[model samples]
Target: MINTILPKPFLFLLLILICAETRAVPVPPAAVAYTADIIIYGGTSAAVTAAVRAAKDGKQVIIVSPDRHLGGLSSGGLGFTDTGNKEVIGGLSREFYHRVYMHYQQQDAWMWQKKEEYGNKGQGTPAMDGKERTMWIFEPHVAEQIMEDFIKENKITVYRKEWLNRKNGVVMKKGRILSIRTMSGKIYTGKMFIDATYEGDLMAAARVSYHIGREASAVYGEEWNGIQTGVFQHGHHFKKEVDPYKIPGNPASGLLADISAEKPGINGSGDNKLQAYCFRMCLTNHPDNRIAFPKPDGYDPLNYELLARVFQSGWNELFDKFDDIPNRKTDTNNHGPFSTDYIGMNYDYPEASYAQRKKMIKAHEDYQKGLYYFMITDPRVPANLQNRLKTWGLSKDEFKDNGNWPHQLYIREARRMVSDYVMTENEVLGKKEVPKPIGMGSYSLDSHNTQRYVTDKGFVQNEGDIGVKAPVPYSIGYGAIVPKKSECKNLLVPVCLSSSHIAYGSARMEPVFMILGESAAAAAVLAIDDQVAVQDVSYEKLEQVLLKENQKLRFGK
Candidate 1:
């Protein structure tokens, strides 16, 4: 019919146009309904552990992760374990360390260094414990491999690099999450959901109540809740007076970079400032496994002027926090007044959009990389410390895909859920008993500096570096992980559990995250079996199941 309506040349053009138009129109793929019994949202250690526990309980589980790798900080380079009291770390968390021990028991695991060369030194404990058969410290790749093994052994499905569509991604009906959609338009439906992310992205999208930044000391009756001006429990504070101005003692010349001009808020008063964050650098001195720190784009020497002044003041403890792990590597952390922590730079990270968060993360990475470059090459830095640092380089085998840099930026604190019962200093210091104990935390009330500001005496000092030892290991309540019955019924949050800022500092350790992840999975499964909201899961039955699964609910138990 078309041939009959036009000449030969016109008809040929018409056919070509039709073909081109057809090719231009893209046929969308059929939508897949990704359904699971339990959908855990995150790629942290908690996400892996939660998936494993749910799969072990005979429920189809899935991990919708934004990360390409598993094991958040545990595999991101925090190889030097921060276990406070290893006695209380049981269940899957302890099992993870035991697996690390088993791997190291093989002679092949010792690749860079010999077994005898790597001594058994750890955080106030033996790195390789023969009694419990647990290894506390390990390389990043080892931890990642163990986590991958967990997923493979349990046959848990993980959708990696799937970013949650925070805006209108969640479908909630009658206060219960029905499904969550990722940015790639993949829909995931589940009977129960677990928010195991460090950022608490899914929990926030689901409209669960949460707190960001420090609450006042009066909010939770916690002494360490708010802005700490004069308190310096750790050695990260400024020990000597450093000039705050660009020019020595000249206020009009403008304050140096990274030092805020605002008044360090009233002591014990609340403000919306987050603690500083840094990458837990994994460094090695071995010639075979070393990649010299590259100068990041936009490197500047003046950015680290404050540290140069700190050096001139005779404060030279640069190598203090380079805590060693196996294979002659170090889990380098922020130390001294001016170290790896990008203070006053991460205030907007908790609620930032994905695009904005990417910029913030890039800024932090650049700052740290530039700092490392400065320490090694800058003439202003003390010659002795500079030479000592020149020997260390990023571990070649660790985070290889990321150019030997740690893949995860250590998010020390983020969106903490505001559930029915908030864990506070009262519970941590044993001043109050936890209700329906689910797990235990023994680490001290630790928080990194939030701001670097000038003191009233017109000298520079760091603010909010706290470290208060707990009286003893204390129980973590079930209510800390579940949302209020009215807020959300089917979801559970473990990593960003309900806790005050100071209390979360202690509970934010990787082992505790794994412990809570397992417990949250148990509760989610029981809630599904009972057909009740997570808030209504009976603590009696939950406790019995936890104990049966070898979870330590108390220190002595």
Candidate 2:
């Protein structure tokens, strides 16, 4: 009662503090200007290749990248390339691997161990051979150096840490994009543009049509495009009954675990979600070159309870698929039921903004780092399993700037452009022929599980994962790179090429991206020569250029 009234002096002081806190700081935006004949707007492998090719073609080209680092995941610890058929790789993509071969020729490249001690066989692709036309498998820094060499040798103008404006800032006149603005208030002008980003942000901002999440099988007459619940192939599903409810078998007791209690969608139908994403962590066993995994802040043991259950289910085969690279380091990835992929958690990331995407990437990092920390240190983990995991640590030479973390997160899929020619499963399965070949993809139609849910028998399981090999290397159409002529005329999209989900699963490989990049550049140059939009580039002329560049359009005998 006595303290009900506030003192006049205290009130005045509080008001003054509030005013000071609310005051805004005035700072002028930085001004930047650039002009080029061709402008590439991503920092991926494809972006680098396209910019270099354009520069090599004697076009004044510039690369504006939001990333501080180049080469995306190619240099960001995915040293074990995901190339399907090495024979199909040519031009800049093959050149990248040759540089890796050159880097390892010297004894000094083996910083941790002897060259012979390191296994040449890596994940998804074959090892490097000096005389062979194709090369794959390399170290992280080696790839980065190769890309830098490409840029330096070509003298391509590059602007790092620049992002494009997503609003009404892409200036266009007479069906050609004149210039584009960035959030930092910088403008870039060019005759032709390539939206090489995984997310297709530039294409979207330019009023081009794009898609997010997987489409239903029915939408494109695709057999494997939608929700697939009963098909579990990778040994991740539960074999025995386990309750999904909080109380053992009672539905009224509420749902258990981290899953949203929402109804699991019907099988083979569309859903507004994408597969989970994870970092491809590079680990080393060399004591001097390894950084021990640190316990993350806000660490929760419950987040990894599923992994413990996976372990308890008599699945002791841990060191089965680790692809060993140089320096006694392994490019560790998803194995068994609960591995590196934090399933069902990265649905909204494909369309999210930079700030929101950052938060999602950080969360994935925390989850994966915590998973490792918990496995090695947690008392619940089997002693045998702990001993094996304890031998591994983050590679000292890789991602040195960011606490030994891989620079790129695996963006499995993103906004695909709904262009004139959409690649489908029929083409990949060799049921139908694809005309106007620009590139080829030979990897399996692989899509990781989109969700983990409880089954009817009250057992937890993973769903939406599919892995089926393509019948043969299928030709990627030139029309897939451009939007319908009515939508956009001057844009070329390499990363988010038009394709069905199943077909994209195969076409989504990095080498394929580089191949497509080269083709896109050739088309852009041809378009400029003919004085026509990208959509108007003649297929016969484009095919001739691709063949001359040594691109494998059709599968060879």
lDDT of each: 0.93, 0.81
* Error at 178, model 1, angstroms: 0.5
Q: Which lDDT tens digits does candidate 1 get at residues 92-173?
A: 9999999999999999998889999887888879999999999999999999999999999998999999999999999999
Worst 10 residues of 2 by lDDT: 235-244
lDDT top scorer: 1
List runs of model 2 lying over 4 Å from the truth: 1-31, 123-125, 239-257
Q: Which candidate leads in TM-score? A: 1
**456-538 per-residue lDDT for model 2 (tens digits):** 66667777788888866778888888888887778899999998776788888888888888888888888888889998899
How many clashes does each candidate structure show, in the order listed? 0, 0
Which 10 residues in a row give candidate 1 its minimum summed lDDT? 1-10
